[model samples]
Target chain A: MARSTLYQQVASELRRAIYSGDLGPGDQLPTEADLMTSYGVSRNTVRLALGELVNEGLISRTPRRGSIVRDRRPLLMYPQRELTPQPASVPREAFGFAVSQEGREPSQVIEVSIVEPPEDIAIRLELPDGGLAVVRRRLRFVDGQPYNTNDSFFPHALVRDSEIVRPGDILRGANRVLEELGHPQVRVVDDISARMPTPAESSRLELEPGTPVVEYVRVGYDSDDVPVRVAVSVLPADKHLIRYELERR
Target chain B: MARSTLYQQVASELRRAIYSGDLGPGDQLPTEADLMTSYGVSRNTVRLALGELVNEGLISRTPRRGSIVRDRRPLLMYPQRELTPQPASVPREAFGFAVSQEGREPSQVIEVSIVEPPEDIAIRLELPDGGLAVVRRRLRFVDGQPYNTNDSFFPHALVRDSEIVRPGDILRGANRVLEELGHPQVRVVDDISARMPTPAESSRLELEPGTPVVEYVRVGYDSDDVPVRVAVSVLPADKHLIRYELERR
Candidate 1:
């Protein structure tokens, strides 16, 4: 019992050092032998202390390179910016635009299909019973690394004739296509939560162990208050930061 | 390798059942012996499958209860509501009001202290070098269950003499005191991110294994654009959902 407590104490001290920037990103932790000697603990206790850090997503350990602190600089996301009108010269989607502004390349692979949506999504869209929907799923990447996913569903009857049903990227964005279809969304409600990734999500996003994902869902409504679209995004917690700036009316 | 794949396949089937509501919350899964017989797998594989479900926060296991699905209904939070003006008749803070509306009792224990603030918070408040601030920290509960934490910091020079520095709950909230001090916030910026909780946070919040937390930071600026307050909330992702309603002008 005392040894278990000692390991936790050692882990806490190391964590404080990392959070205080004394041990920065890409910085190497002390060798196992060194840590064992300094803490005056056995090799097993030192390994257990290091293992705790690994489970916190604070550092990664490898046989050849030892343990190194990870780069935790998250991508700042301005969700409100999506509603703002952008200059005509900028003809890119929000994710790509945000990435480019940071000098990082963004890319995605999209797959579109028509099917009966999930129960929760159908409820959000207020679709009639057995109503079908067009779903566009995207696996997005940052600088060629898979970063997140976006899956958007629209009432099939409302968007069957639009480019949303077609393939490839919507260079001008699907929102414009919705406007062209005369179903422009005038309002949206966003719900945000976080959870551990399933095995499939972990492999697909190439996430490190102990990393969690934020699930953001947005339901859009047209001027008539008819629900139009439901977009769900799964963001790796370590790589994304969401921001909102508000002013008193 | 085949056995490993078999366990994952079993875990996936159970997961689908849970997500599809075929196995609702508080429902019990088949006994390990039954599962082994049904899937034609060894007892080891059955345990592995159940372990996966536990790790996903979908179910819990014990010597007596076996395995039961977890209740995942999260409390909805409307963060934007805080900025809107409230009627004089309602003399409660946002969290308490929201909880009461949901028919749950809300309470908190607050501790007030004055000290040199953390670096990030000091920067958000735009405090000069070596400046101090007053922080009111609260550990809130709902229906007698520990919920989340809110820590609000104000520039010492701005509210050193105000009620914010006094220990105990603020009946009307610290924002009202700030207004009385002639530094009403005209604008605010909110930043949200998620991460695995540190050991200290995990114990204080009584979080389950594999649970993550959302770190929400808000900086309020007065008419002169000088930041006067910075409030940070640590929300357990499993029990809270944040919502934002937006309308295009």
Candidate 2:
């Protein structure tokens, strides 16, 4: 038991190091010999400790890099319901659409355009292949630091005819544009996933190497159950956090 | 337009190569000279093309390795509601517990174990700060391949005094265990995020570079609205899909 306890201790220390940014993502960990010398443990013990961290989604070992610290960013999910307000009046101060209300107050800058979407996106909007759709791509920022990127698609017919569809402020957000089109979202379905950040995504979101990102593919449907819009957002896991609430009936 | 289009083509080809395992994760890409010779493109064009690949999360470049393909394994998510039997009546299977004649087949693994959870988990379960709890972990396999991992926690005192708290099979599942303990799950809340897989996650889920994953933190509440169990699951996004239904009054 005492021998195994040492392995746990090593794991805890390594975890703390990674969390504290002493070891950045893709930064090579000390070799086994170095770890043994530093921690005064057998190679087997070090391997066991490393294995536990692997299971918990921490450090990753490459053939050449030894072990690199995995990015431990918290996954962030912007729930669709948060974007879809009820029919009742909501205070303007309560609007968290374009910016984080408190704390760091992350704001966003976006470029919205009505373009001919690709086949996959066109299908989502129930538009013909090569048909035009309003595609809004936003480069989100948390305290002026780029945090995420969002791309949303809607049938052009719905939004292009609206006054808000102009490219000048295309990124006011998908929901706001939807409101102007009178297809207020009544329901939303969110499909989420995570992966390593793209180099561009890494830079845009200021992601570290070996860090994973979360993607939320949300489809908003109106009262008639017609899917109105589709939005895909990729977020770096280490920075943002996702929270949910469940109530008993 | 054609000049830029060619680079997009090159990027897409490399993406397919990575996904199809023609270029396995961690496998180095052709050197600039080699790529230039192979693709009949200038050095600048190849670099620009590679730049786009990095942006798309398809490859990673190291100081020495240049560029290596990413793991492209998708995360899988099994909905929490799917586990709840729509047919309330439990079927009497080989074990004392009930099984249903469902559309899908359930494996015959009598997997169950009870142990103390980690510190972070204890806080999530709200286990009275150092209080003991029954921590059960199992990997659900379908047709001999691992599908998902299940880990559940219960207050130690509640299950320790019961017959279901054995080291072997801990009352089928946490839900059944709770039902047997007379505190059925009355509510469930799930928070989800998606991102690219880390190297470790890729190996565990048989994913490759760019393969996405969905991380879910699910909390179950009992009839009294008290938190009962907290489960954290990572699903491969490619193989698993989530469908949710929400209705308005």
Candidate 3:
């Protein structure tokens, strides 16, 4: 195996320190001059090492602040679990349950309205052209900080008078309400991608500059293979990690 | 519903044109002055509307070239298919197969070596302290363009004499080789996250300045409940979309 270069070796050492909790979030790293002097390396090498940490999202460099370690604690999200039946004891929505399990306070502001769905969402929900849908839009917060947004669309004709059309949180989750309405989702398809956030999303989530967001979309189908619900989530890349487990059948 | 602002209205028109392919990839958008005149809005509104497209990653701006639509063709990846048995006629690896299915040629360069695995890989593979592993590192390509990188690691003691120790591309895939050697993977766990690319990765992948990368890690376990393989893939965020289908049990 080829040996690692000087800059890589330096980066590895700093990474180990950060991971081992020797250096923590918001802690300032040694200045470039100090690092060069201590490691017997050139200024370019120290800069390169620092660049690696910046790319890893472990540290941020500013003209005034130099290099400060970033908060690397990402919330774990199980996309698979969101489709399954939650235990009766856990009545909160998936996001709220997950955050509360981590000992974080979870809260959300919701607004519901009926409108002609977007083109992509119309196709996902299999609504007719010009068909209206009830959309429940939510901006979720963790410990009083905006974390993410979730927007779920349901066919207006199917859920016109249902609780889904009301402007409030569904304490038992909208999925359970779907089951009670005889449109239980038996299958779901999820698509995940990432990109820079729009100005509205950035302001809503209070995102720092250079932060990207993961767009997760799920199309759920009933037992008869009829598309019932379409959920779109925008999760800040720095604050969320998605996980899935698959077993061979 | 509240009406959209002037800038938002402008942005929506442009977004609709792009989505409808009326303004295709590489097509130049109207200049700020032209948009201001056409929409009967001020230069600030035009600039804000343009900023919206930039943040959405739908266009690029340069001094010489004002704004051009970006290529939005993302390679779709199914992480769940990697562990499943391939059809009798299709013997290629999951990545290769997926690319080929999209009517694109797939290729890769492989490098094999034995070394002590990284701390995270060691823990995932459940290797003892200081234990070594054989890693097959691949730089994959699509239609002659550098696409992504996949590194697969296996316990050295478990496959020392197997074909996995050699350097050439495994036409039947290393997973098949593992099955032949009595360590078929029966379960797998996938983790997905995104961050900016390191300088080396950016150069290697020939990525643009603002492109982030999705870091995907998968751990495979054999029927005996022993970890057999750990695969890590770094995919450029702009060039990949991951999808999964789930069913209620």
Q: lDDT winner among the candidates?
A: 3
B1-249: candidate 1 lDDT, tens digit per residue = 012378779987887787566888999999999999999998877776777666456788877998999886466788888888768788887888887765567899899999899766765676766899999999999867789999999999999888989998878878878888998887888888899999988998899988999988888888877789999999999988888888886
Q: How many backbone clashes does candidate 2 have?
A: 38
RMSD of each: 16.0, 16.1, 13.4
Query: Where is model 2 more than 4 Å wrong at Cα?
Result: A1-99, A168-173, B1-85, B89-114, B161-164, B167-173, B193-213, B247-249
Q: lDDT per residue, candidate 3, A1-249, as tens digits?
A: 123669779987887677566788999999999999999998877876777567456788887989899986567789988877889988988888887765667899999999898666775675665789999999999878899999999999989878999989899999999999999998898889888889999999999888889899898889887779999999999888888889987
What's the TM-score of each model vs. the native? 0.74, 0.62, 0.74
Give me the overall lDDT of model 2. Answer: 0.61
How would the docking of model 1 be graded?
acceptable
- The whole-model lDDT of each prediction reads 0.83, 0.61, 0.85
Chain B TM-score in candidate 1, rounded to 2 decimals? Answer: 0.72
| Candidate 3 lDDT, B1-249, residue by residue in tens | 123679779987887687566888999999989998999998867766776566456777786999899886577788878767999799898888987775667999999999998766775776776889999999999878999999999999999999999989888899999999999988888888887889999999999998889889888888887889999999999888888989888
lDDT of candidate 3 vs native? 0.85
Judged by whole-model lDDT over C-alpha atoms, candidate 1 comes out at 0.83
Shift of residue A217 alpha carbon in model 1, Å: 0.4
Off by over 4 Å in 1: A1-70, B1-70
